[model samples]
Target: MAGFWLGPRAAMRGYRLFGYDSIGSTSSEAMASARRGDAGDVWFAALQQTEGRGRRGRVWESPSGNLAASLLIVHEGDAASVATLGFVAGIALQEALSGNLPASALRIGVDGADGLTGQGHAARLALKWPNDVIADGGKLAGILLEAQGLPDGRMAIVIGFGVNIVAAPTGLPYPATCLHALGTPVSAEAVFAALADAWVDAFELWAGGRGVADVLARWRRHAAGLGSEVAISHDGQVVRGIFETIDEFGRLIVRDGARGTIAITAGDVHFGATATSGRT
Candidate 1:
């Protein structure tokens, strides 16, 4: 087992650690650990994943040299607390990465015509609310939080994280970008080290009665969709609106005039320019 840290400040806070060299899917492995009743902060990490997964049952491209890991946290709080996992993970990862580089230089997105950075005065890396990390309009990392219904009227959540460290796969469902594309090289060990610390910090906040509102605020600070016109597709219906806030329950609030303000709990949100008319 390789080394893992709870945080830069705190030691392991009641978490039992599990590390692996390689696995089929970190999410699957973490969920298994939860099922066995060993459910503190368990992390499943591997140098390579043979069969990784993403949202909507999509297969994640988990080639070698990327970060494929998942954290299984047993629900001890309410449903809202459980749902904040994704937002927490996103914030954690962002904090971890920011510590390594200048905030502006670390921002993820496309280089302009003259390869100049955008006009955000404060160094900003936007997020695709709920579960995506974007820098400059391209995908930096994707997150999927799955809950397994236990027999005893309980559920275990597995937070799966796929980050492009060395490379991002081409010809995928959505246009993929990696840290390398931005001239930054991320190592697996370094990524894991920062992630572990960030997770502990995020969960601690949730445990302290911060609620989803706090998560929403942090997410919006780094979100890619705020104030932008976008389309959200779910169950064959499409709604286009100016991206708005996420409510306390973690639902997206979209203002589309005719539809008023629609709360989107689940859907594929496509930003404009790259926006699709509907789901593929």
Candidate 2:
């Protein structure tokens, strides 16, 4: 990773890389590259993102020493098919982090990610539905997916990863943790180096939507709050229920007492105690 070269597998697949010490947003850069007709299959990574954004237009902080990366793929297929890549990304991020985390954090399971310490104890790692990696209930990383149509009936899809390697943002609605905070201090570059390669493994498993079932299975194994109390806020309505399994297409399915089975296409999800906190 001297010059941000990806893992051998990625390189073999002809994937390219562009590294920056600071940038507005790696995802934005990826789309720009696509717009310029630069054949995709490239990753744009930056150490700092001054104008990063999260799902639903939330500001994503990417201070120096954190990892902000976006992978652009020039894809020809239905947009629905490409959406499954989000799960693929969660799997890759988990695999990369599990490989890079301190052995102490590689225990049977990580219950939460926030305010954790590596004080001679093991931790569990899990994925919060859709696009987040967590230790216990604390958020360690997040994913954002974006797509733009090209004139050739194809699309430029960018899946972005923002990880807290050295520092986590403050005052978020939920807890945020970083490698340093977990006592497994590591450089953002090192994380990206591992993540770049891990993406190859997970992406291959996905096989461009053909193997999504397997991806979904792996995702389920590491999913958090699957059988826990949950709340989803959508369009001024709050749906409270048990965190049921995700449907085949990856939509979250909630089992409500009086509402039968509810399939949530998109919404802000909260779990356990937070679900009843009257917040979206």
TM-scores for every predicted model:
0.86, 0.91
Error of 2 at 88 (Å): 0.8
- The local distance difference test score of each candidate is 0.70, 0.83
| Candidate 2 per-residue C-alpha lDDT over 180-212 given as tens digits, one digit per residue, 9 for 90 to 100 | 877777788778878888998998998888999
**Candidate 2 weakest ten by summed lDDT:** 108-117
Which candidate has the top score in lDDT? 2
- Superposed Cα deviation of residue 226, candidate 1 (Å): 0.6
Tens digits of per-residue lDDT for model 1 on 1-280? 5443444532456654556666799998898887888654677776578899888888888777778878887775656667777888888877776565445555333321011124545344556766876655566678899887776767788988888777787886556666666666767767777888888877777663465567666766666656667777778887788777777777888897887888889887787554534444
Error of 1 at 133 (Å): 0.7
* Cα misplacement distance, residue 44 of candidate 1 (Å): 1.0
Candidate RMSDs in Å, in order, are: 3.7, 3.9
Mark the 10 consecutive residues where model 1 has the least summed lDDT. Answer: 108-117
What residue runs in model 2 are displaced by over 4 Å at the alpha carbon? 1-3, 103-123, 277-279
